[model samples]
Target chain A: MPDPALPRRVRVHEVGPRDGLQNEAAVLPVEIKAEFIHRLAGAGLDTVEATSFVHPRWVPQLADAERLYPMVADLVDRGVRLPVLVPNARGLDRALGLGVREIAVFAAVTESFARANLNRTVAESLALFEPVVARARAEGLRVRGYLSMCFGDFEEGPVDPARVVGVCRRLEDMGCSELSLGDTIGTATPGHVARLLTDLHAAGIGPDRLAVHFHDTYGQALANTLTALRHGVTTVDASAGGLGGCPYARSATGNLATEDLLWMLDGLGIETGVDLRRLAATSDWMAEHLGRPGPSRALRALTHRDTPTPQDKEP
Target chain B: MPDPALPRRVRVHEVGPRDGLQNEAAVLPVEIKAEFIHRLAGAGLDTVEATSFVHPRWVPQLADAERLYPMVADLVDRGVRLPVLVPNARGLDRALGLGVREIAVFAAVTESFARANLNRTVAESLALFEPVVARARAEGLRVRGYLSMCFGDFEEGPVDPARVVGVCRRLEDMGCSELSLGDTIGTATPGHVARLLTDLHAAGIGPDRLAVHFHDTYGQALANTLTALRHGVTTVDASAGGLGGCPYARSATGNLATEDLLWMLDGLGIETGVDLRRLAATSDWMAEHLGRPGPSRALRALTHRDTPTPQDKEP
Candidate 1:
């Protein structure tokens, strides 16, 4: 049983539709991506990150978001929140044109990753996102700010907890509804997460105003998520099929698989309202479309054990 | 800086040499396995699990343990503890014949997994290992008992924490030096872990007598490990390059990646004597040999960042 005083079910933001597929080599059909988003929404995810409005040259895989977003407009009619990633003023402009209600901006904690991955320095990237946030607020759009490499970075090594707190404060002050701290390189341990969260909490960042995005790069994402939940964080980010990886980092897998996340949450008696079996099917669907084995270890295990025969390898 | 009460370092039992390669499809050469063990020892791990004495049919990967064990014996002379896995009486007999000093035995908490994976029910498996423990004690060999599926299982679903405690107590009664609780399917969350540890502690299972074995299946292994560590459980089981996976459940990746574990411990100022660089190199070596990428997300990130040019492929 859950403590009545504590939040029983955290809000999980499904990022596979956007962040998960955007990094893949395979360019999924717009219909397939739309179906995945619809299925994820049907599975009861609080927020489905639909697509990124970045330049095609940067992330070619998601170049079809223009058509993809409108295809899932029925979700919006049903009152489901669909947030899209807006990298800059241009991305925000495009997302706004698509009638996006919620927008997300991402920056890194370290300058190296900011420059390498996002093509901007920490200060420069945050500066670029400020006006976008302002425009979104004026347009009655909800804005979310994400600070990547909050725990550690691939290029610069261990991240200072204070640096994360500083970034969070900035994002919060910038009119972002929620600030997400990401262990971008998947280098965090529970102790590191606890220490960082505690420090941030002491710095006056309330858990309700915070979210955590963990990669299964090192298989510590869910453990890190649990640590955040204990601290009263209500929002988490997960990818379906665990389908995203850092293009800059080798051997990095993807984010915490949503089905696996739902599995653990279900077992804990927490109410996420997500269907594990349905999510597993969606993962299998994407795995087949991608022409690669799905990155989710948990979904594969469930399918293998539950399926009477192993012949259904196709989507 | 570390807490004054914190030990500068913790012992990392590198189970990859034994636990990892045991489930691998391609059998490594005996010299390669020996070199792998030697490198782990040189990397400052206080204990490196070297080999198992299970029948070759049970685990063909480590069939050359006869030649591999004696080859790495000098590490013990240098104060490294080499622990071997013994399935039952016959396995123990063979290990004792090799002059084994330390051994480990495991039982599953779920009846279905116990019967399917271990060829016995929970009670019967426990009974089968009791005589082996007695013989190990008589022969002056240290014994450690592992309780698998401590969190939950694929077939049996959620397992009772009380049952885990009962098994731990039974193993202690059989003269086992330590009891390791394994979240075999990686379904445990931190709350689940804390509650289980608290219940076990209240049941008189002291921290000193407890060890933790975690799989990164659901990306919660390290967080669960930290929960156990905070409860004063010291010894941890990890695999190099995060090499192992459940043969029964392929998507359940192996134990927590050693690099990810060490990186967190390093950041927290907890001394885990394992050299992060050497450990990373060892993972890279193994990955190269296997024609697969290393299992660790953190190691891969660090290795990629350090390389002169970015890696074109996943490996």
Candidate 2:
């Protein structure tokens, strides 16, 4: 039981601007994207995955990353650590040239997902990421590894927990500071997660070294996160308005909604340092700008059909 | 960890027609409600909570429970276990008159919610239920306990986990065959559930003595359920199209979406005796009928777009 006296806090990593926007057909303007991140930062999120450094042909949604990076230079100028996704050494070089201080590298756990998503075999993908992590570490930049399809895959029957552990071990050895397991296809259950994390923990993986990335595709991400937490995993990846999807995974929803996650944390006596009401407003604004429905249920239920009071309209 | 050989099977107790409808605004016609229950049963849900026996003034949606019971003779004739909600002695008396074989009784974990929702204190609610359970047992009827706000409540924040354990123990002592802990306001985080269940376990509450009832209000129900599973919880309460909400708590979302739960369970190598494609179709039908969007992301995504066929749709 939590000591009723001790203050509880949780860190929420915002992946909307990168993981969220990457899969949307609507290409937001670089300024809008920058403003989006700016708005998210103002909401009290500590770390936000800002953009990806992949070639335009690979992910055109972030082709404006170069322009967007300079637009948000004010954040870096203020010492906020905004990380960018780097696909390979070339992507890493591009990010470095842009004066990025932190980078994220990802590889799929299952061979099918890796081939479908990254156009490479599992081993080949990890091999490609090895030097990128080393280069980033050598340059004094923090490195985070994403292991996608950690639970289930579309084409693959079932992702082996052992394979995920193996991938995580490799990433850690390559100097990846944190390992974020991704349920790319959104096919995870709490039971699968509990069993897998038990194995992951027994395999010498510590909670501090792990983060969880879940899609709401199966509505089990939050539950899976809790299962991971039972074994000591803390850091979680969420998207504002619950935005983002896997490009290769059809019918997949966005990452676990950030507003929803914050609500739970807030109620649990776990402080997320997020102004949930403000986060709801941010989600609403983005939904309006994107011409799509704001996906967060908490945001919709809290803000819609209700007039804002003076305190709500202040910012 | 799981012997890597045994199959994981989850038993889903669909409460949409009974627990769900009892909390909705729409007063669905008896025929429509019957159709809804029939559809859920057709989707491979072996246990469907059918209706509730409560005063019309209290729950207008389930006011016609007595009338709806006879309409489901087709289900009873087919040997489907259709359980109905009974609020108190009077409700139980009415259910018995209808020849109901199974009934569910509910009490809140927090006194505030009990008083607000049921106009009684937790003790008063349980006291009122003593005769109901006693009589049900005399009638050879199966009884289940619905522990509302087991995680948290709107008026009473952070319910004492011990209080929850105490109420559950009392209900079990009263012959409740299955005890369901509800996240009535959906304010539970994975960490919170981990702590709560851990406390319950320490208090000698076994997983077999518990069922998990979660809401997606904060989108952590699945995660919270996963936390329960980590502690060995098997039975879960879900609503079709995520149909259900708290009349007292205006913005609280419905119970965990049944189709979404089934999808994750299917993926986890868990046998739920539920069909994913049929569940998705049922949700689609119900969503259209209700003129509202289905809250199950898995069902929505599955029906909304084309999906690449999984190698094995069933384990």
Chain A TM-scores of all predicted models: 0.93, 0.93
Error of 2 at A122 (Å): 4.7
Q: Candidate 2, residue B158: CA error in Å?
A: 2.1
Task: Supply the global lDDT for candidate 1.
Answer: 0.79
Model 1 lDDT tens row, A205-278: 88888889987765567767876777788788888878786666545568888876776676556778787778
Query: Model 1 - which docking category?
Result: acceptable
Error of 1 at B244 (Å): 3.2
lDDT, candidate 2, residue B240? 80
For each candidate, give its TM-score against the true structure: 0.88, 0.84
lDDT of 2 by residue, B63-111 (tens): 8888888888578778688988888888888998999999899888888
- What lDDT does each candidate get? 0.79, 0.78
Give the CA lDDT, 0 to 100, for residue B206 in model 2. Answer: 78
Error of 2 at B275 (Å): 3.5
Clashing residue pairs in candidate 1 (N, C-alpha, C atoms within 3 angstroms)? A223-B220, B8-B271, B9-B271, B10-B271
